[model samples]
Target: MCAKQDDAGAPHHHGPGTERDTDGSDRFEVDQEVQHALDRLTLLINAAEALSSTLEVDQGLRRLCRTLVPGLADWCAVDLLDDHGRLRRIVVEHRDADVTAPGLDEGLLPPTEGSAASVARALLGVGPVLLTDFPPPKDEDDPLCLREKQLFERLEADTAVVAPLRARRQVLGVLTLARTRREVRLTEDTLSLVEDLAHRVALAVDNARLHAEAQHTAERLQRSLLPELPTDGPLEVAARYQPASTTARVGGDWYDAFVLPDGAMALIIGDIAGHDLRAAVMMSQTRNMLRGIACDRKEPPGKILARLDAAHHILYPHQTLTCIYALVERLSADEPWLLHYAVAGHPAPLLVTHDGETRFLTGGRSLMLGVEPEVHRPAATDMLPPNSTVLLYTDGLVERREEDLDRGLARLRQHAAALAREPLTTFCDEILEGMAGGGSDDVALITVRTAPPHAGPAVATP
Candidate 1:
């Protein structure tokens, strides 16, 4: 009757101090101990991988929680301090989907000082705390305390480990774990493992915060430097820009449409070669230089770019870029509107007709800016068909990783043609909605919509 005489089909447990302890039969117990050690080692390895999986904080933490639940512990909860010095409950996870306590959604928590002593101590960077049986919160009036009480009642709380996530002499957050069964109390060994995990989590959180802050500052600076487009013009102009998604990868995509000293409207879109802050700085320098040269030189698109290339060669050497500089104008009322443009190692301009036909403006091509200053950058001209739109864009709009360059070009063309008949803003919006979804590269594009077929030699407004 002792332990029901365990058979091979059921798990066997040898009684302590029975014949197994002193005789040669103790080999089985030794084997069990070795196997348990191996399992713990495996869990630690997996936890490290999960924590370092991504630079995104919430995503990486969720991965870590999944690696722990139902295996390391029955429940895992992480609370992180924000830049505003507020404690935010980032995630709460349980092995079973049905096991949830009332008012247990993730959000900002009440000040840790008002909560249970264990949570308060952990947040203060006091060493790890082992939580066992405790009296129901003395004052359940506190939201944080009340929530913990509810969880204890609902999950039949047994044991828990609370550790401060500390890195660089500061506590960034706290990690909490709990198990329901009382027979297997979380021991000191478990406490050591939890502290190691908290250390890893702290470093990851710090890196993610730094990246986010940098990205925000860079984007704000970029927007501030961007020039406003002309709202009232015969050629209805609209532009769009989007930054790359990689962490801390910012800058280099820009678009501008404005009037030069003369009567012609200047259209410009370009991308500096790299995707870092240096790339962004060069982009601003290169863009401002081009605008100045265009205003003072009074030349065609080709010659204007020649000046840009020369100026940058002296001012910011060793930097390269792809660009399109075009002027859309008609000398007189009886003349047809014309587009004169030049491409400097840039993607060909796309032309979408009023009837859903698409074509690339492939003439006027030359090397990128940094390569050669003296080469004659060629120029091309095409008459604007009534209501047709010319789309100028950076490579990001028509290029992607591991895909043929032609394929991205074809995708852009297809999306542009389908939206050809829509309004100017909608056409640009839909094109972006269709082509720029989740692209990792930065993008800048300008849509120049001409007046309808003309009464004179030029296409005229109806």
Candidate 2:
């Protein structure tokens, strides 16, 4: 038998200043309606506040399921449509959340055909459906509906309200609120409040989903822009990039290596100022501009960076960048590798000798790009041991908020010296694993080690 839900009881109408009709029912009815309206408004406000607490769609939905229990309904479940339009039950909660949670996690898909949980119809803009009674016993129920009926029977709920969760006129999911133990059935007024609540919840969920999708797209673009290091060369190159774990969007740290016209290999590592889509775009443009200048000009690292600095106003105005540009060349087979590089507002690269000695290549220092374009930039050259490794990295490699930059550099030097005897690829990875864990910044590292005389080509293992 269907039970009719009643509003909250009004206070006694025979108080001293209270006015009443002859039958004395008018004031009582008006007070009861006012109380019901206040309760509905409170429920709506609480639901909105709970759902707005998180930007993670699944977490928001879970909170939404839990928020509307016992006070608003005995059970609440949300079914969201996946990309391919399949209905998936993402959250299910009850008045007694712990016990009913396992049973609620059936992960069943709602029906597409003729069934009460017609998610497809709901997506097509159906407002809400209120069911007063379950179908006849012989009618088979989909797994989701069957679970709902089982919960309803267990909780002794005789009424159910299903509404579309919509945002900006687009239906994103379905919201189900069922009442049990209370004889108060969902009336028209209550259904209207349910629809409003569903609308607010949908807005939060949609915002979170859009953010996740944008991050995914940005990361894919980031991966595509990063180049693979060469496996066989006079200097074996290994690289690693680890984005900040705290943010969803990709950062602007990048590394590039290409063979120059003079048979010398050029390596560049840079980081732009921000960590969003605009920063990523600027990073790509700056990298490409540097590549063009580096290749076409056939100049030393210092000159190329100077020219890039001069062009910064036209290319990326008011932007800041830190970069290390270096050219690796060996004149003859008998001599050691000659390393010539220039730096602009970047952390000094590290040189770890085969004998386990480590020092930062601190000689090449200049104002960062875009700081003073016409300023004369200086270049530095070092005679690297045949088996020595040079690491060109972004500032994230040796920067921490808690310590001084000099201290972080000293720590990195010590670690590099300890791992100097390992293979080149392993050496690079070990340094990254050690340093990249604690920071909330992007890290880009390029490690190049001159091959020992007649040594086989070094493999790119990163």
RMSD of every candidate to native, in Å, equals 7.5, 7.0
Model 1 misses residue 158 by how many Å?
1.1
State the lDDT of candidate 1 residue by residue for 1-462, as single tens digits.
245445666755567566546665578788888998898788888988887788789888888888998888888888899888888888877888677532365778777765665666787778788878756778766667776666566766688888999988999988988888877678777988888888888988888888788888987777776778876556778877778777355678788877876778999988888888788887887888888888886798999999889988888788788899999998876677789999999899999999989999998889988888988998999988878899998887777787999999999889998988888788877887788777888888888887775522221111
Candidate 1 deviation (Cα RMSD): 7.5
Score every model by TM-score.
0.85, 0.79
Judge candidate 1 at residue 414 and give its lDDT: 93
Candidate 2 per-residue C-alpha lDDT over 1-462 given as tens digits, one digit per residue, 9 for 90 to 100: 333444664444454344435436776788899998898888888788788787777787777777688788888778888787777778878887565763455465755555554354576678687777766334475554565566567655677888898887778888888876546677666778888888888888888888788777878888778887766666788888877765755778999988787778888899999888788788888888998899897887899999999898676777888999998888887877888999998988889999999888887789888777888889999999978999988888888888898888888998899998898778888999998785788888998888888987676645
Q: Which lDDT values do the candidates have, in the order given?
A: 0.81, 0.80
| Residue 455, candidate 1: C-alpha displacement in angstroms | 14
Runs of candidate 1 exceeding 4 Å displacement: 1-40, 100-104, 111-113, 333-335, 452-462
Global lDDT of model 2 = 0.80
Residue 293 local lDDT, model 2:
93
lDDT of 1 at 432: 79
